[model samples]
Target: MDTAGLEILGEEECLRLLADVPVGRIVYIDRALPAIQPVNFVVHGQSVVIRTAARSRLAIAATGTVVAFEVDEFNDNCVRHGWSVVAVGRAGQVTDDQELASVRQRGLRPWAPGTREYYLRVDIEIISGRRLRHADAPAGP
Candidate 1:
């Protein structure tokens, strides 16, 4: 047998869950259309940092705008609990080469091959999250 659904977890649990995962989804508005993409990120202080190719959508999305990031996980037994944290804030490219290089040094590699000529640093503003523990999640956090 198998079961699947979303459960809302507590705030502490949400942060803990966030630290356990390295990948998340970043949602942004593009020309009035909503776009979402999975990305590898590091939670730096209150912000999320991700590396991207020079001309990729991720890079384009980071041009002085706010974006959303979500990460969640489930158990193998199909009985699982997970949470999603959304960071709504302004996005920008990390201009300092030294800082960018340091992120590379931290072992955050890109899934896409070839030269990753750009990196994005998203400063979180509204940090709200929700956890999925059962079938019905209230109104979210």
Candidate 2:
């Protein structure tokens, strides 16, 4: 397939790109509807960790369920070129004392100013990414 000239990224490259970005969107169900919300995250082990308030929609929907997380970077100054990585996995609340301590050590504080004490972890079971090249970037074989 032509793939519309997008470059398909490998798993390692996808994870690297994910780790390079600080913010991503979490896709989950809210009130029985699909929703997306921006969040600050960190790559720990083979999972993505997110911090949020106890009662937030994400906190409520993320626990013990499957969700999708995505990150992207683009340059629009002169050309519209970017790369996006999407990760899908089962998410669960981080309740173990040791794991909690470790994630806290990562210094992943909430971007939004408020009391956010809950930590959610999503295991990166399936990950894929694609790159949109500038007009000049070669479509390498």
Candidate 3:
């Protein structure tokens, strides 16, 4: 519903916005339960690259399974200006030597301390987003 100036964002716009932000939430199963963790990510050619600690719960469980990654930008002060994007896909580790090397060059690192050497890539299977803005504000550049 486009209520109160809310609009569904197109795939292109959603992907664009996803790349603009450096952090997002990764939603996946941890011990048969739903878990979401804020993570630093980089959008690399239709995939979200994430770095986590090796053998960590998320790095182990989320791999080879369906997961959802979400990113959003909002200005609380501006009551009606914000956007959020979610990408649901299969998460996998970047084990390929060449691929891993390329991703390492992209600089996707964890914000928290410690050695988070595990690298995961979540393919963008189903992507969607919504944007809320003042009615008077125009859409698109």
Candidate 4:
């Protein structure tokens, strides 16, 4: 079997990509308006963790919300294809002291400056991934 010029990553590879990336775009709705924001996140166990301010939009939008967490990587030369991992899940505040302690021990830090007082855990309901290549055509002309 010869695999060449083909880009197909296994589930483990996708998980590796997810674990390696620190920042992703989170998709949610605010008052029926679509929104996407770059967020700092960590993949813990089978879920995704995010730290935000107590009153920030992400913290508010994530409370009891079903959202999308997406991460991807690409190169300018395009010789190496990029992969995307999308996690669809419900977001909620992380209140368990033990869990919070464990998360803190993992060295997960907030991207924004100052004290990030809110922590959210997104229980992953569905996880899927796709690959992108320079050869792929744009959706529209």
The model with the greatest TM-score is: 2
Tens digit per residue, CA lDDT, model 4, 109-128: 88879889688888878776
lDDT of 1 at 108: 77
Per-residue alpha-carbon lDDT of candidate 1 for residues 119-140, written as tens digits (9 for 90 to 100)? 7888877666665565542333
The reply for model 2, stretches above 4 Å from the true place, is 137-141
Residue pairs with backbone overlap in model 4: none
Q: What is candidate 3's lDDT per residue for 38-73, written digit by digit as tens?
A: 998888888999999888888989999999999998
C-alpha lDDT values of all predictions: 0.72, 0.89, 0.88, 0.78
Residue 71 alpha-carbon offset, candidate 2, angstroms: 0.3
Ranking by lDDT: 2, 3, 4, 1
lDDT of 3 at 40: 89
What would the TM-score be for candidate 1 when compared with the true structure? 0.77
Residue-level error in angstroms, candidate 3, position 92: 0.5
The 10-residue segment with the lowest total lDDT in model 3: 132-141
lDDT of 2 by residue, 1-141 (tens): 136878899999999999998899999987789999999998999999999999988999778889999998876553457788999999999999999999999999888888999899999999999888766754432
Better of 1 and 4 by lDDT: 4
Please give the lDDT score for candidate 2: 0.89
Cα RMSD of predicted structure 3: 2.4
TM-scores for all candidates: the values are 0.77, 0.90, 0.88, 0.82
